[model samples]
Target: MMVANEDVQVAPTRGRPATLSADGIVDVALKLLDAHPKDELSMAKIARELSVSPPALYRYFPTRTSLLNAMSAAVFADFPEMPADRSWREQLLAWQNDVAAVYERHHGVMMLMGWDDQLAGPWLKVQMPVLTLLHSIGFSRLSLVETTSWFLAATVGLIRTYLAADSDGLSRSDLIEFSEGLGGLTDAQRMLVEETREWISRGDPARILNLGFEALVDGVERRLGSLQAKGHI
Candidate 1:
């Protein structure tokens, strides 16, 4: 179930100034992330930046890991609401592109997405919409779960790779050239390099995400069809 916008409220802290809400803390953290890479942004640093005592920061975050988990949830919440009229593939691509943009804007959060604890809250909110899409497309319950899991993994993996590469300040063209220079390239490898260059030149994240997502969807659909033909669905 996609969380209703009303249900996504940050817990209100008592006795704090109106400006000292969790949302305000997340805003500060995002600014810090934009200024520093993931490994460099610390809870102490955020506290110092906000001019709050470290213990005061603990009143909200409790620990560095908890703070990071909150940050990850914030990232997911920042995604633009999906368009209702788009196809499932289109919706998924849009969602992935939105996530990629957020990761690009706050490169620090990319590192946290890999940790299971950090990802839990966002995953709960994410999987339902994806599962609903799969169900609408005629996927069985078990297959819907499996396929959505794979899609999330792939989308996050791609975003992680993209952010890590961006942090190094390597242009997309540079990455393509580097990939092409590797020895023993298979035809598929060359094609990927070419496609990557095109995607980069166009500055089209949607195209890149959609291409990868569509391939995954195609595989899932084919498998589902086969299973259904065998009376599995």
Candidate 2:
């Protein structure tokens, strides 16, 4: 997400001032985060980039947790609203694509996905659209919460596995050697294993994510139909 540089006039100084706003800190922090994992990123690095002391940052964000929370908020600041013109299923897929796009664009976001108690506002902003859609289709209370949780959990797991598999750089020779090591498989098991191996070696993360989403939608539809039949909605 691009942070706009608002035209705020400030007095000239020999060096950067400690009065740097929280937005300014978050902006620099995000740039650093893109190149460095959260565990390796230090406040001193941000301070150096801003031409200020590390202690100065605490004036705005008293702790590292607070600063990380602010960074998370900025990462999702311009989250797209689900389109009003699409069918509900289409809208849900669009939302999943948009959310996945954010994760793909900002590699650092994977680390920032941990929910922070201080970030309820930003979390709700990111989640409420999909949650409301599920609610509209007869999911309620505990089921509503569980369904949303399942979708997000599945999405995150798929992306993580996809990236790891993509980096494997497995070759035909590698797969052949690996396959030869496995013995005692029935013909059917062998076929299934080879197909899965081939798919995982070259599968598109987004396509797999969409397929999982479609499956979830189908399950939800079936549940809603059953509830309607039983007069539960």
Candidate 3:
């Protein structure tokens, strides 16, 4: 279900100053969230950023989840509309790149999303276009729903996994030092690690993410081909 654009943002409370408006709180929270881990961006931290007490923030957001949902709205508010002229495949690739850019920019914002489905505006903003394209290509209602779910899961999973890996993966020096310790391994195990060391140690996150996404789209295309062979369309 797509949440309306307005439904994701926090509404202003009466009596708050413009500087302490709902949008203001969301903006500060997003900035703090980007700089810190999701769990660290508490209401108190946001309040400190704004030079106010936690209670003052509660007047607008009321709870940390509300503020996080509003921040999500702010992040996705500028999600671009898909180009009308592209083929379905072209649009799917373009959409994957664009969505990757957002997740890359915000880093860990996915974890901050509200659990309540009512706050799903950011999700649908990125999801609905692909689902619509698949539907246009003759995916049945059940297939459409199932395929869209898999598409979302795969896209988000690859991006999140790579982002974490890119940041937390060993440094070059660390990798070299760790390689020394691998002498204790069996001959076959050591040979495998030596053969794949560079690839594993320096996985190009963007390239891997794009490849994973493209592979997913390729599966969708193959499924379309199978259905066409049966004259299902």
Candidate 4:
């Protein structure tokens, strides 16, 4: 997961306001991400939002990729520093929650996190902190690395799935209509759907994410116990 600070704006100061800095550009870009979807975000659109010419943005970002990298960095800037005193499970849960919140706020970036070179720095920075916590909790170095990777991949995949499921453009109504025509599901099935939808309406992503993390940790603890019993360490 790409973790960064909330987008910070270039503040107007006593001196002439700084020309569009990387920070300024990222601030506008984040706004644009919220205003528009990932498919719609563009350098030209960001320049327009910032009230600057495209060339002016180029002086700071150089290319669209560079701007994206900056935006990715800014997203991670808000991540809470890893706590030294917390138990490893507590630390991991906190980190996962923080990443999930970041992904929710910048849902557009979920798409980029899987592909962008911009994520590399934050990924590297976070890896050791996470591994150290896992190791401290009795994970072997290899186990720590593998577990961390699995957890991250699973969380990111879940976020992407959640976003895709909630997207308005997909039209769940159409699916219902199609199913109705096919006599696909009985009335009982349709009613179950209504109940499920109602439950979903009240569900919070943060709560759901925490629940998932707990389940994962439970499973890992069981396996770790087995490994220790076998004297694998």
lDDT of 3 by residue, 70-122 (tens): 77778887877777699887788788777777766776467544455443567
| Cα shift from native, residue 186, model 2 (Å) | 9.1
Cα deviation of 195 in candidate 4 (Å)?
4.4
The candidate with the higher lDDT, 2 or 4, is 2
Residue-level lDDT tens digits of model 1 in 2-96:
11112222343356555566777878987777555634665566666776655556677676667666777877775677677997667877777
TM values, all candidates: 0.67, 0.70, 0.77, 0.72
Please give the ranking of all candidate structures by lDDT, highest first, separated by commas. 2, 3, 1, 4
Model 3: residues with Cα > 4 Å off, grouped in runs? 1-19, 38-40, 117-119, 165-185, 199-205
Candidate 4: C-alpha lDDT? 0.63
**For each candidate, what is the lDDT?**
0.64, 0.68, 0.68, 0.63
Which prediction has more favorable TM-score, 1 or 3?
Answer: 3
Which of candidates 1 and 4 is the stronger one according to lDDT? 1
Model 2 worst lDDT window (10 residues): 165-174
Model 4 lDDT tens row, 1-233: 22222233443234333676778778888766754553466666676687755556666766666666677677776678777687767777777777667766765655344344535465456556766776777878777667777777776666556545235332222234333443677799878866676566566755765787777666667767877898875
Q: Report the candidate with higher TM-score, 2 versus 3.
A: 3
User: Which candidate ranks first by TM-score, i.e. highest?
Assistant: 3
